[model samples]
Target: MKTLQVDLGQRSYPIYIGSRLLEQADLLTRHIRSKQVLIVTNETVAPLYLQQVLDNLSDFVVETVILPDGEQYKTLDYLNRIFDTLLTHKFSRNASLIALGGGVIGDMGGFAAACYQRGIPFIQIPTTLLAQVDSSVGGKTGVNHPLGKNMIGAFYQPQCVIADMSVLSTLDDRQLSAGIAEVIKYGLIREPDFFAWLEDNLESLLDRDVEALAHAVERSCRNKAEVVAADEKEADVRATLNLGHTFGHAIETGMGYGSYLHGEAVAIGTCQAADLSRRKGWLTDADVERIIRLFKRARLPVEPPAALDANRFIELMAVDKKNVDGNIRLILLKSIGEATLPVGVEKALLVATLNGYGRKG
Candidate 1:
């Protein structure tokens, strides 16, 4: 297993990546606070890998809660189910919660772990590529409010993150591409060289070349860990992580959640931001072309979803957690490997990009 440490002082933890890491007891034994464990997963993943995880913990008492699949279920109602299960089992503060699926599972389970008895230790066993690279780290846990995406989360950190790459084998092609969008983001915001590598190795990534996937996942996590360690609460430097999120969350919420994968929505949002940046002189047309080219190669939709009207898009963007005062701020490209959050970006330019709608990536 390849381990990456997120050094957040006392809250620091390790993200373990590899095949069959889920079945390794030492991965959990070293981090877990107690023996009473609850493995929270969705219906889609519970049947596939839950038992394998259970077999490894033959020594510890285990309970399983299977939530129905999809982003729509990532709500307080679902979180209540975890609490209800814990209460039923008489679980205490010493017990641990295991997030055993993709991003939704990790977010929801992490949120539940954060709030229960004020807070309890939780482990992120992220199964999807998107989860492995983004949501599973940083401990930004919360259930989405009807009003906005992740509008009600806390800056709570997790005990550890177990990213078992073996889980990617079950994902569909669309799901695979969604994960690549974030992989591409790490390259876009911080490491230009990784972006260049992605441009050169797009086909290898699509083909599941093990070395390429490992490099992509490792570098993305390393970049994120450094960022999260610096700004756990997203005060300044950390906000850069929202590269495509402001527009992406609006797209997901404006139309409806689960209509598009989180990473897929971000891909379109990243493209829209690229266009806006080019118009504002922050990025060149060539830069836009290169970004869209890499996204196209990954099979992600570089075009915005049709349902997000300009006014509604702006409205959603207005309430973004990243916005300061009334002006919208965005992580725009200075170039492929570098990005910046320029405040007070003109609304007209944003509208133009949104209206560009079907522009080919």
Candidate 2:
């Protein structure tokens, strides 16, 4: 078992990552003070690992609400269902919520817990690799609105994050690839050495090598934890973590929710950011090629969705959360291990880059 700690002062918590971390009752006993417990999951995951969590929390009064799985279901209407479930049960502030699925369930459950009587305790049992490495770490929780992804959300931290790698065995290839995209981001944005490390061990990771997966999960969590500890509310330094998000969110939103996986869009978006950097002479083509090569190895999409047009792309991006005043503040590449926000990217350059987006037809 591998344990990574996210130190947020009083709100600090542990993210337990390993093969069988899910079945440990004591893993959650310390943080859950309530007898009333609600475990939130989706249809797909409910059939898989819900029993493990329920058995672990047998001492507590466990209630459940299973939503249909997918990005399209991540909306206010679905989030309201959680409220309805909690209200129907008469769960009080003393109650606790457990997010037992992937990022969607975790975000919605955490948000529901945060708003339920001005915040109650919640635990994150992130089942997906993407959820374990990204959503389960930063404490950013919310449901997506039609206009943007995670545009309407809160920075509510969970009491703890339990990441059981064993659950990942049931995940489909696309979901696994979505996770590797995030792991790649941690390397590209913060740790140059880690980036090199990924370049060396791509095959082992793709094969689900236990040691590789554990190290990747731990290192990615560590990078995110450091950023969260430094800037909990994304004041400035933390926004760098949004590296390819401005364009990626637009891709996800414009393509609609389910067209591409969140990490799939992010994979292509990172490629685009690197391309933009190369165009501006910020990153060498060699650097860009290496980044794309790694994404390909993970089976992640490295090209944008073909349906996007430059005008629509720009219009959607204008509304990104990272935009300040009227100008879009993009997190572009500086090098393999570094990134930054250059003041105002040119319109022609942005349009041409969008026009040149290459991917499967």
Top lDDT: which candidate number? 2
Cα lDDT tens digits for candidate 2, 163-266: 88778888888899999999999999989999999989888877877778888899999999998999999888788888878888999999999888889989
**lDDT (Cα, tens digit) per residue for candidate 1, span 280-338:** 79788888998888898899888876666788889989988767786788888888878
- Candidate 1: stretches off by over 4 Å: 357-361
- Evaluate model 1: give its TM-score: 0.97
Q: Report the C-alpha displacement of residue 231, candidate 1, in angstroms.
A: 1.0
lDDT of each: 0.87, 0.88
RMSD to native for every prediction?
1.5, 1.4
Candidate 2 clashing pairs, residues 3+ apart or interchain: none
How does each model score on TM-score? 0.97, 0.97
